[model samples]
Target: MGRSKDVLIYIDRRNCDFFQNISDKFQVIFGLNNFWLAKFFIKTKYILFVLVNIISFYNNNENGLVNAVVAIFFATVYLVKFCQKCEIMEKMYEKGYNLFNENLILCRLNRGLFFVLLVLFCGMGSALICLNGLTFFVCTHMLLAFCIVLIICAEYFYACTPRPKGKSKVKLLFQKIQKKIEKIISPEPVPDSC
Candidate 1:
């Protein structure tokens, strides 16, 4: 498994770099305030899930308490992992979450959309299951399955898209040219004059 992961990481290094760039931008825009709010949203979402489960506990006939507990457990673990990943991004940049004012609004908007989806899906699935019979149950199950597949696809696309080789080579050459120009224009550092 570890070997496979390493190979996957190697294959997707470019996408990983792009993802890191987006994460850096998100940290700048959302800063600590929106990030913390996102955390709160996650917690509240979980609480809402638990409350729904409790309300429907007596009515559950299929997966029952077992499924509810498992779902909540997985969701909580994912939330913690998400926060840790965000923290690592901040550490990588040597800055707090609030580096770019322009990004803050975007970050908030992105997270808000995510929270809305999470609640809509989880809450609706839980409620629908208790209110009806086989049709509702199957529909909720399919919807949840679709949601999981969508998330998997999004992750893969973000982590595995490769740049065309010729385009990448040209981009590198232009970057080198830009660096050379900067070196020529900048004042030289004087040794032992710090």
Candidate 2:
């Protein structure tokens, strides 16, 4: 609610270059909090899916290649998650920029938690194989493929779905800031006398 003068911004190193640019532009328009990360995921997932599949296909091997495939998938997911986070944060600052707002902030935090879960699962699956040998390898690949599906679904939903709440966050924030700036510049209203 209150204007924040100092805030530390965090960026994930795994973010794609193009995504970074888009997020920056979005922030300029909306603010950081208003940025929607899932929408970006929906936008980029297909391209990412194709690239990941190509990499996995080439890297696919019969001699315990599943581990490598899973590793690559895990890494890619990490990158996507980071890019999404950056975009959402930027949007928040631009459109949903409320340092004192609780609901919107919690939503972003929920997103961060989901990313953490994805990473944990990736880590767990990978570590299980490294520690337990071939026993868990096949299972890990199954999980990796499942994660890929989830990514695709997310992308599709973001592209097609009408999320009124999300839309409002961006729209209302923009209106709020615009009115505030106008008020600041022109505080007094003129009265007409007949």
Candidate 3:
């Protein structure tokens, strides 16, 4: 399985093209936020899973009630996370979720993620409040989660920065370069015979 040749190809050409067709149809959305949305959910879930394991393993010396509460809280968190991951991945590929056709979809997604940031803020507050139960590993994992989410959120928001009206200088420069390249690449047209 480590080698490319050792892997089996389960998807036939037909099924593969069908999905590729969806990708081509929503190329714009996929090119933009869908991928970042998927990344955020998957990364956040990874951290949540780690935190859950750490809480269960390291809290043996602590009060059982506190341990259970922390474990349950993390469990609920990851459960929601898994669902969110599935939802975003599902919508990302589905033709029904075209961002261009339904312009507000992206707007709604932004709003939803902003709400997720708020929820994470609340979790950070709770984690800080429960510093009594903190272990080096536990605190590190939670802080890692906070930092990872913060950085991804920053990048994702930065990606959504609004452009000013009309073609920007960078775009115009690219178009000029493209036109010159095309001119050089094309053969001269032959004179039409009467």
Highest TM-score, which number?
1
Candidate 3 lDDT tens digits, 1-194: 55532331222223234433443343333343334443454456556655655655565555745765676576567546645644554455353443432332333444345446656755775676577655554564565556445433432332232211244455567789999999999999998994
Error of 1 at 186 (Å): 59
Task: Give the alpha carbon lDDT tens digit for every residue of 1-194 in model 2.
Answer: 13231221132122222344554455555544223544455436545544545555555556335655675566667656756654555455447454323433343444445455667666766777777555444464545555554553343222221112343357788889999999899857677873
Cα-based TM-score, every candidate:
0.36, 0.28, 0.32
After superposition of all CA atoms, the RMSD between model 1 and the true structure is 16.3
Candidate 2 structure, TM-score to reference: 0.28
- lDDT for 16 in candidate 1 is 39
Model 1 bad stretches (over 4 Å): 1-32, 92-194
Question: So what's the TM-score on candidate 3?
Answer: 0.32
Worst 10 residues of 2 by lDDT: 5-14
Q: lDDT at 113 for candidate 2?
A: 52
lDDT of 1 by residue, 1-194 (tens): 99975765464454435555554444444433223433444555556555555544546857677877887688779767756644554353344333443333234334335445656766666676777775545455445544443443234222221221233344567789999999999998889966
lDDT of predicted model 2: 0.48
Best by lDDT: 1
